[model samples]
Target: MNVNIITIDGPSGSGKGTLAARLAAHYQYHLLDSGAIYRLLGLSLSEHGLLEQLNDDIAKCVAIAEQLPIVFKSTEQGVVVLLNGIDVSAKIRTEEVGEYASKVAAIPELREAVLQRQRDFAQAPGLIADGRDMATIVFPEAQVKIYLTASAESRAARRVKQLQGMGLDVRISDILANIQARDKRDMERTVAPLKPAEDAYFIDSSDIGIDEVFNLMTSHIDAKLANN
Candidate 1:
């Protein structure tokens, strides 16, 4: 039988990751944190101090993306990103890495290099992918597509709380500004700009809880799977 796919596309802090994880667990499907893939690349580039060279040499970024020794392990808390056998889950969550990921994520060649890696995650049972362009670009043919979103301020507030829980002093205003900026970049980029697929189901998760979002998503997913 062919593996099925469900994509959840959203801006940062829109609960895409949480919803994707829940759906993955519920359906016994694989989870693909597509944003984390870019963030991991960002972390690698930052570590090697090659972020400055990204614009000058696109090939270098593509090279690093292809050679990344990354692994994703599901845990009681959530997914953990391991870089070359070293757990860098927290390392890649920094604001700086996120900004870098957004920048390099716009490079068409860089995205192409990692696109197949994202596709390969669709194994046996199924996959739940979460990212800005998951529905639009990476998994256009997915059986189910969801576009989740919230106001910039709301998302910023959520991000602030998450960072605070991680012991990071984050200001809501700063995060809001970053969200707005990233939204503009992701929407206006020349390659694979962030947008919902034509047939995607939309959910504004600003006021809803995680379980509410999961229920909404599963309703559509269940319908799709039943038909399949």
Candidate 2:
């Protein structure tokens, strides 16, 4: 099958997830929130008390990734994630889970285990992959590679608003610190570090709106598809 792919990569809170969803809907394509895969694994490890042993026992983490009991179902509302036959769409989005995911993602062996699962999402129509390494590692040959980013302060502000809307009490300072730490971990990782592919189109969304970002992406994608 010849499947065209668009990869949107960036640090957390860069609005890549939202933009990827919009692009998927617009093009009637499959959407892969790749980061969620790591987050789900992290949540599972936390539940099993193995998160702390990631560095000590790499084999176990790879085992879990190879046999993750997870499913992603698309609904009108959005993608609902199921872990072990139970929905964990909300559970995996917590800040704690995000931190756990960063730790596990840094392990090269575990990433290798999960890589194929992510590739399976590419199908006949197309795919919009969103995550830190989508462009840099996962989909280097993607036709449309986008690197969406924003200032640390802007990302933290957006995250604060999102948490508040969910009725969770969060302080901007704390969120900012977490974002900065995650950025460091993601970029400095030994394997598949978070960085834009050399040929990727970069967009700084610090002072822009979603609509504008979407337009920019679509325009580029449309041109690429036409040429392809």
Candidate 3:
């Protein structure tokens, strides 16, 4: 049997993370959240007070990215991010860490350093990879490539709801602005800019529910698999 790999590439708040996990479970495949890997590196650098040294010392940044003590643990809730044996799932999801992750990821050498580590997750039964460049740059040969997207306003509203559920007070306006700013940075970044693969099936989930999106994706994947 051929190795089945599904790549979901999108910007933050595009629902790629949730979609990837669901697809992984539905197919019993391994999951890779490439952003989390960079987030772990960002968090580690922040803890070491080296985030500011990224552009200044590219060599140091590459060195740090080379030895990331990160692991992904699947659970009833979702995939949990572990750093050095400690659960840091919640810690890496903050806007601060996301910004850091984007900045650090822009360094070409740093991305190259962790490229193989990300590729290593593709194995056995299958793999569902999710991130900004999963389809275009990381898993170009994936059997199924999806580019999930949403309007900035819609994405910000979803993010606001998530933060409110955590009892955090956040303004929708602020969240929307942040989303737009992050979009600009991610798309303009020289290395691994956010974009859909030419062959990717694009889904704009601005007004759709997760289940509907999942159904659409599974339909696409099933058709692709049958043809393959």
lDDT of 2 by residue, 179-208 (tens): 999999999999998999999999999999
For candidate 3, the lDDT comes to 0.91
Per-prediction TM-score to the true structure, in the order listed: 0.96, 0.98, 0.97
Q: Give residue 101's error in model 2 in angstroms.
A: 0.7
lDDT of each: 0.88, 0.92, 0.91
Per-residue lDDT of model 1, residues 1-228, tens digit only:
588999999788788887788888899999999899999988888788888888787878789999999999999998889999999888787888889899889888889999999989989789899998888888888989999999898899889998999888878888988999999998899999888899999999888888888888888889988997
Q: Top model by lDDT, which number?
A: 2
Model 2 scores worst on lDDT over the 10 consecutive residues at 55-64
Provide the global lDDT of candidate 1 against the true structure.
Answer: 0.88
Off by over 4 Å in 2: none
Residue pairs of candidate 1 with colliding backbone atoms: none
- Count of backbone clashes, every candidate in sequence: 0, 0, 0
C-alpha root-mean-square deviation, each candidate: 1.1, 0.8, 1.0
